[model samples]
Target: MPTAAHAHAHALDLGRFVMASPSSFHAAAEGARRLAGEGFEVLSEIDAWPGGPGKYAVVRDGALIAWTVPEGAGATTPFRILGAHTDSPSFKLKPKPTTGRLGWLQAGVEVYGGPLLNSWLDRDLRLAGRLVTLDGAQHLAATGPLLRFPQLAIHLDRAVNEGLALGKQQHMNPVWGLGDPSAEDLLGVLAEAAGVDPYEVGGFDVVVADTQEPAVFGAHGEFFASGRLDNLSSVHAGLVALVQAAEATDAEGAPIAVLAAFDHEEVGSASRSGASGPFLEDVLARIGDGLGASAGDRRRAFAASWHVSADAGHAVHPNYPERHDPANHPLLGGGPLLKINANQRYATDAAGAALWATVCGEAEVPYQEFVSNNDVPCGSTIGPLTATRLGIRTVDVGIPLLSMHSARELAGVQDPWRLSRAVERFFAQAG
Candidate 1:
């Protein structure tokens, strides 16, 4: 169990991380920056890798993979991986982004994932992502409180207090300013923020983000509210654990610890940098080759490996108790969640559950089991995909949250710190 002061400190750091990571690309870059600051060398895919007994990190688009190799690591040394995603549900900017009618300057956007549409209404928004130049240079851009999606006044729609209906095409466009679309170029705004010429930008991958800063509120200061907490919470936990594991002095026989933060998970994870893609495989293969691992040796190493897939799970909503499993009512501050799904939506099995229990027990942390109601459809995570792709044993685990896909999400302040401590124990534990 973490003390209140320690938990509050961790939550403040998480808030800083969330504020720095407005987009997936920014998340990966921020992760790499932090890893580099901790003496981890940044490796480029185009360059040759110097593997063995060192800490290294690499970024592929919006995804990041980092690992720490011990002094006694060999070709058959097993790996302990923590997997998380970097993306959240939001709207993405479409091509010919500048669009408006009359006096309203609106930007063209496409719904990227399954976000709570009603929650995006009447919130301040900003555009953030990477801008690619014609010469293949990438520049990061972020606008601060530049757009808004205002709701219709109740006086106009007299059926107030009724269900709100938001059309994806007709009602989702956000207004940025009052100007003519032809006269104003939205790309110019991003280009200026990135300190690059607008004409140099050949393409872009931008998304909208909530501009509100993360807050720690609620009775007794027990609650934490922030945007993009769905997966960033997991990513931050893995990062903190990995950094601490790298600094440990007694990691003589421990397995290689890895942190895999992927992108595009909210959209089914089919992109080049997603878990379903070859980015992770490519990095692992290269690392194996550097260790002189043959096919048999690589298989032996993988056979002993373990992957912990961390994502956000639902805490029983106070008003929607019937939607959750009656026997399993996970609370916000109860600890982290060990997610289980009968239909293989999550990859946790008996063996994985046992392993998770052992890890948590060693760390002296409590955890809750999460299962969906039989009538309710359960959501999936990257656990099954990673297990299917690499044949490595995987367990699905996460911290409980209240509003899952809302523009802003909620969590218990202590749970995030507790999750990090458990992950650090997992990383240091021998196979």
Candidate 2:
């Protein structure tokens, strides 16, 4: 929490972005817009890799990757890549969703990721995702919107806490406005939002999302909460630093700025756009080529390049502090946490960890350490995938967070901007 005055001073427009990015497509679009506005060229994957000066972007189905090469970059130039994901855990829309219980029509939904099912109850949810539209049999366009997923009230369920359970195909669907909700009805509404013909909407991948936006909470607004912070917080940080990375790249390929936001990490990163797929490796290799790295040079260039996989770290919870490693209980607002998992789940070895610590020190950014107790199995991220794929040195680090996959998560407000600043410094000097 922060005081009102201090809270207003925070630079992040977290609220504007929270609901807009319910799906990775929307996230990619937003970042692409920003980079394009900065005069960065939005490169078409359909085109051959253009190894010229200036900036460029690549957009897959639901993912966007971008970068800026200094004016004189050539075969010897290596990129400084920053990686993060764009998907979040949530309830998703189904094909034949229609349920009526006591005159209330519920929309069908399927769980998307490892969210705390309990926390999703009794919240205002919206539906959002990409829609593919086909015209009279000829024209087609993509549409995206933030839609809703409503939860039942506690009063409706007297035994909510009495070992409450829900069959995903049964009780978890949400009831929207009053009436029978056929896929047609909602598709019409979506068509209106996108200025398309309802008949033109061929298919969609919309998901339920919290209607709430990110907000400053706590006494001084030091604490932030709303929806989709699990990774959007990092997304915001990455974009801001990216905008700045453009300026710093004027140093002649000293440190080329690369932003990697992959899709499908929430599920398995197996999709064409997923971290486990060719998105990262292909993009990095292409960057090597863009910088004039031949096959032999690509290998050597990878040796010198370092990657920072940005994700949220688990924070010490007030009610369950003991759950964390006693010696490394990362606290919120304690700066960023350099996550180290002894099992290599985090991809942060001594060299990687030391790299981050040194960056934090030089930037005067306060930081903490986090590692799950040896007794507790830990989660993983793109760190290992990137390390193994490119043979590039990698590290995992991020702001500490509470309720990682919940519709609404908590993080330190100051940390968001602090991290952007440090990452800016990193991309400016990673070489």
Candidate 3:
């Protein structure tokens, strides 16, 4: 177990990361900033690569890949890849989102993923994303709370307690204020936030987010709550582990360590910067070519490589215990969980599962298992997609969480550091 001070520090860092990242673009930028601070050289996709053991990273819009080449390893060496996504389920603004009804101004929003809609109602919301200027430069913007989606009073709908069925198009648009709504109004607000003129705001990729700050609570501050914990928590752990592994490489000539964070996993990961796309493969091939490795060598490396796919898993809910498997339930503050499914929803198999067990056991980190109820369908992560795409051995894993797709989610305070330490140990492995 970590000392009390170390646990508190890790929780504080996670809170700051969750509050700073309201969109995928912001999360990628944050990852890049941290990597650069740790002495990793940032590279462009169009540029040629350098040779031999060193720290390097590349960014493509909302996806990023960073790696540290081991001191005597060649391109044929296997890769220990840590995978996580940068996106969360939320309401994104359409290109022309301005509309008005009954003296109220509202922004037309499209549901981006499978979010708990009721959790978004009546909360103070803000807008944050990337903006493109007429000159072709991009800028990031995050404005304070500027919209509200108030719920209907129980007096108006007497059966509200029965259930709430919300219409995505009708009841989900959030009101900013009362006025004759115009695209210019929203554009002007975004332009000011990005320090550009309204005319210069030629395009935007924006999303609505809750403005409440993350909180750490429980009898001893054992749990923390925030948005985007589904994968951002994994992102943080991978990043910290990669940094530590880079600083102190294992002497056993381990494979190159890589951290790959993609953007659109929540919406199916089909975009240019998504896991289903060619970003990871393209970069891997480029690295192999740069190191003068033959095609056969690259193939051999793939056969030997392993990927750890980390996402947030569902913790057994105290209020709804029956929703989880009775014997395979994961709990808060119990370290990380290995997610499994017999239906191939997850990429874990006997070989991959054994590797993860060894890593955790060697690090002395307590771990748990999570398998959904037999009758209920299981959710997936990038593990299956990446394994199918690259033919690399992959295992699905994550920290236990509650209200996973809610605007605000819950997780253990200690699990973040536990997962990080386990990943560090994995990267330190020689095989």
Candidate 4:
């Protein structure tokens, strides 16, 4: 178990990380920046890679893969991979975003994934994403509090208290300002923030994000509230663990430790930077080639590898206890979760459960099992996808959370750090 101060410090760092990452592109950039600061060399896909053992990181679109190869690593050395995603459910800006009616300037958006639409109402929001120039240069852009989705006044509809109904196309548009839509350009706002000309932005992928800063509230500072915690919590944990594993000097016999953060998980993860795509495979193949591994050696290495797929799981809500498994109630602050599903929604099986128990035991962190209620269908993670794509053994795990997929979600302050500690132990143990 981590001390109170240590847990608080890790939570503070996680808040800062989430604040810096408004979009998946920004998350990847921020991760790469942090890796570079820790003596990790950037590996460009277009350039040749060095075969020597060292710390290296690569970015592909909104995804990032980083690893540390030990001094004595060889062709048949297995890998310890920590997999997580960078995206959350939100509204994505559509083409011709500028619109207005009756002097109110609004931005056209489409629901990116399954977000809590009601929670998004009346919250301050900002636009963030990558802007690509005509020459194919990409620039990151994020604006301050700029847009808002104001709810209809209860006075207008006295029956609103009975039920609050919202339409995706009719009522979800967020207002930015009062002006003529024909005269205003929303892309110009992002371009100016990015220090680029709007005319030069040939393409863009922008999404709306909550502008409120993350907070540690509740009677003992036990609760953490933030946007994008659905999966950023897992990403931050893996990143911290990877950096710590790289800095340790006793890694002579340890396997290669990898942090693979993919994007588009909130959707179906079908993009090139997604887990279902070839990014991880391509990177692993290159690494194997650098190690001078034959097809047989690579297969042998993969047969012994492990991938820990970390994502957010549901914490038994006080008000909705019936939604979770009656016998297996995961609680916030109790510990990280070892997620399981009978339908293979999660990749964890008996072997994976035993491995998780060993890892948590080695880390001195407590853990809880999470299973969905029989009446409710379980959500899937990158675990099954990674296990299917690559023949490596995988486990699904995460910190428990309440209000998942909301504009701002809730988590226990200690669970994130606990997850990181367990991940560090997993990286240290030889596969």
Candidate 5:
């Protein structure tokens, strides 16, 4: 059960998470720090597993998996998995990124995912991601507003309102300042931002992001606005649920709870730390091995596991109502959404959808159904990929929001609280 004050505090915490996590690497580090604060042991892939009743977490690049094993839990015990991605659509910096013309310096960038490129124009942008040093270790760095993409004025383009054209290679470069550009310029700036020497900075994997802080707004604070809400919001919700479930006991026979946050979701999730890779599958196998499970026991445990894909869902846009399915449109403040697609894009089946409804109803959590218009193709998430990879029962679910894939997105103020509650309940309940 959650109180009003608890909900408010959780919203505030979510805001902090959004502000702190400007990149996927930072998001994973923040998640790991939070889990560690709750006394969850950090396990390394190279080391042997400590088999026993305990709370443990493993990190691979930006992806993470944390689980809680209850006292007297067995090898064949079922698992309750809460899944979310840490990465969002943004402009990733490329190697040899210096570019300049007409006394202006710009940084070369590549689109990481399908983002509304127009929204990024003229916005206050910064750089954040991992900086790998000469020694082969990595360090994270976030610089304040250091870049901007100025838009052409109506005076320059008389038909600007008619239809603005943005070329990925030609128009998306963000200008930082007026100076001579060099190969060492961006790295030097990054090193200075991180308070380290430029010589020590060997390479980097950074991205340009919005520098604006997330806030709760609207009349009487009925809405919230933030960048990277497409997935980090779900990450925060799942993190809260995992931490809370670790502190509470389940029913007489409940499954172990696990939270898996993966990176590279924006770029098709094909990397070593991505959903298409072996990160989650390997982590689950290692968890089973740590529990002293045999091959058959591990298979049985996987058969009994369930995964909830927590990503942000689309709320019917007020200005673009025609784009939504008339009968199945979701709205802000509508609580969690059971996202479904007939084309298998979402991985939500009839049984999984019903299970979501049952959990929401039992927790007194408001929920709605979302099916894309027949003509509008649905987007993909880690749900389908995880289900296929691990052969687990997976359901797609999330909070309703507008302006998805934009530089900044919006959601109802109450939705985050409702989502966190529903996810906590999902971990609390069992088959």
Candidate 6:
């Protein structure tokens, strides 16, 4: 059981992490740093697996997978792997990006995920993510109050309230300020902001950020309003579970516990470090081979290994209940949502769902089921991708939320704690 103080502290700290992570790359680095603070060493699988007792990583720039070994043990065991993505729907800079002929230079950005476009209007925004300076120094910059998209005044566009549609390549672009516009002017502004010479900044991937501090909201403070919680909430849960499993014995007959967070999931995951690639599989294979798993033993371990693809779930919108399947819509503060889709957009199967039900029962954590309306298309996650790649049984689970792909999203304050507890219990069981 979790104490009230413990839950509060975890939720607060996790909220801060979510807010600070402006992009997937930043998310991965920060999470890895936190894990390293716990004595987890960053290692590369490109070299032979170290094959011993310690936390190591298979890192590919923004993407990373970190895990720890049993005390006084080696790779002879597999681990319970919890997977989540670091990417979310924000804007990315395009090559030769600049706009407004004069007195209105704005940054051009592409919608990363399928985000609700209008939610970005009238909000204070910031810029963050990794940038390589001309000096070859790797710097992560978090620049805020950097831009905004002032929705045309109602008077300017009377049809705005009646109905509005966005064109990603045209109208949705954010205008941060009013000044003489020039395609070449932005480099100067960025250099000034990053405290570097214009030519010294070689390249960057920055996005407009919501300036609202993440906090417990709602009339009773049950809701969490912030940024990037969709996956960070899941990452935090995975971390909590991995630590718990480390304290307990690795299932005498189970693989070691693992946590995998990859970047670029929002962009189709085609990168070398994404779920669509062999990072997860290669790492798992390394763990198996390092532990000296014979063909049969590794196969058995594969058969027994369970994965939880942690992501965020869509909660039925109070204002638009018609958009959800009556039997599948989840509500705020309900519980962990077991997401299912026959199209394989998600990886949950009957067996996987049932396994989570059992884990919830053990942890005494509440849970719910989520399915998008049949008439509408559903977004995808790393769940199915990882499941098919590793041939491992997997379940898709997450906390339900609103404005999923918006620059800022809301979730239940209670949900993160519940997820952490549930994942902890799940890993404590059969690997």
TM-score of each: 0.99, 0.91, 0.97, 0.99, 0.97, 0.91
TM-score of 5: 0.97
Each candidate's lDDT (Cα)? Answer: 0.94, 0.75, 0.88, 0.94, 0.87, 0.76
Looking at candidate 6, the ten consecutive residues that score lowest on lDDT are: 70-79
Model 4 lDDT on a 0 to 1 scale: 0.94
Worst 10 residues of 2 by lDDT: 136-145
lDDT of 1 at 55: 93
Candidate 1 residue-wise lDDT at 419:
96
Candidate 2 lDDT over residue span 1-431, tens digit each: 44334324543475566555667778888778877888888877768887766788888867778887787676656667778888888876677545556666667678898887877777766666777766423222223323333455679987776777766767676666566444336556656766678676777777677766577768765788867777877777888788887876667446667888888888977889988888877776787776667898777667778889988889888898678888777777888889898788999998987888877887778888888977668999888888887788899988899988987888887777667767877787645
Candidate 4, poorest ten consecutive residues by summed lDDT: 247-256
**Candidate 1 — which residues are off by over 4 angstroms?**
none
Root-mean-square deviation of candidate 2: 3.3
Off by over 4 Å in 5: 1-4, 249-251
User: lDDT by residue for model 3 over 42-123, one digit each (tens)?
Assistant: 8988888877778889888878889988777776888899999998999999988787778899888899999999999999
Lowest lDDT sum, 10 consecutive residues, model 3, at: 179-188
Look at candidate 4 and give me any clashing residue pairs: none
How many Å off is the CA of 135 in candidate 5?
Answer: 1.3
Per residue, candidate 6 scores C-alpha lDDT tens digits across 106-213 of 777877766678888778887776667877876676776867876778888899889977778877767767776653566556667667776777888766667788
lDDT of 1 by residue, 187-281 (tens): 99999999999999999999999999999999899999999998999999999999999987246788889999999999999989999999888
Cα misplacement distance, residue 300 of candidate 3 (Å)? 0.8
RMSD in Å for all candidates: 1.1, 3.3, 1.4, 1.0, 1.6, 2.5
